[model samples]
Target: MIKTIIFDFGDVFINLDKHATEKELLKLGLPSITEDLEYINESYETGKITTIDFINYYQKLLPDVSEKKIIDAWNSILKDFPKHRLKFIQKLSENKTYLLILLSNTNELHIDWIKENVPFYNNFKSCFNFFYLSHEINLRKPNHDIFRFVLDNHQLNPVETLFIDDTFVNTNTAQELGINIWNNDPKKEDITNLFTIKSNLF
Candidate 1:
């Protein structure tokens, strides 16, 4: 009955160091990531703020950290893209067994980072029918509103929509909305190996 598949980009598609950027920030010596900084990040994700503005705002916190260094360090979180996983999603997309969609709670800095670092970023994103980013949509995951937004917008039946994410918190939110969910471990499990067929997906 599954007719739609929602994929989370970080752990689901690309290799990302979950804690790398935050650790780098702490090392850079900010008193802490401030509320204003969090606002800038949220604003960036919703497309309400520009990427440059977000970088500049965060830079002010670390007066000594050059913009270029901050940018590089921020982007370091997105490590690499495994070729086989790309091929798996590509193949799954071609078969058209489900309405393939992608959803991620990502910000402008990350988007710009991927644009410059991942040569095939755009092409790979094109594989999805509706690729939704929290910053663009002004909605983030682990929040029920975003989950509901996707379900309502697509006229999707949650029972038939499988949501896969590395974050149990996000998937759990979707699960509460009646969406089928899979929480996979990036270190121990990969989605490419998770699904030989969507029917038997975890």
Candidate 2:
């Protein structure tokens, strides 16, 4: 009875090197991941701070690192987006079998990079009936409010909505709210195998 599908964008669609950014930052003199740094990142992800401010904070921390280098390091987390996934989503969209929704906790810089690097980014976006970006909406995942916002906005039944995310915490939150979930492991699973992997849901 799953009528609406909510998908995460990172790993679930575009490949991401979750550790790449921190590794790259270390190369530019970042000592270690600190509490303040995590706060800043979460703030940026939720649009609590502007991009210019984000870069400036890093510049202040690593005075020797140039703006361009910092930007490059930050964006290093993004990787190749396989076309097969695009085709899968596109085909699903054409069939209109479910109410497709994309709910991602992505920042502006990463999205800009995707638009520039992923040739079919726009087409992929169009496949979704609703596209919600964290920074754009001032909300990030693993939080109850954000999930509620989507459910309320769409008037969707939690039992009839399936949420798929690479992160367990995100899926966990949705499950707590009564939504069906798939906490996909990007290393072993591809979203193209969705129906087979979670066949019972279909």
- Winning model by lDDT: 2
- Taken over the whole model, the C-alpha lDDT of each candidate is 0.84, 0.96
Every model's TM-score:
0.91, 0.99
lDDT, candidate 1, 98-189, per-residue tens:
89999998887788788887888877897899999888888888889999998999899999899999898998899999999888788888
Model 2 per-residue lDDT at 81: 95
User: How does model 1 score by TM-score?
Assistant: 0.91
Which pairs clash in model 1?
45-135, 46-135
| Error of model 1, residue 165, in angstroms | 0.5
Badly placed stretches (over 4 Å) of model 1 are 34-36, 196-202
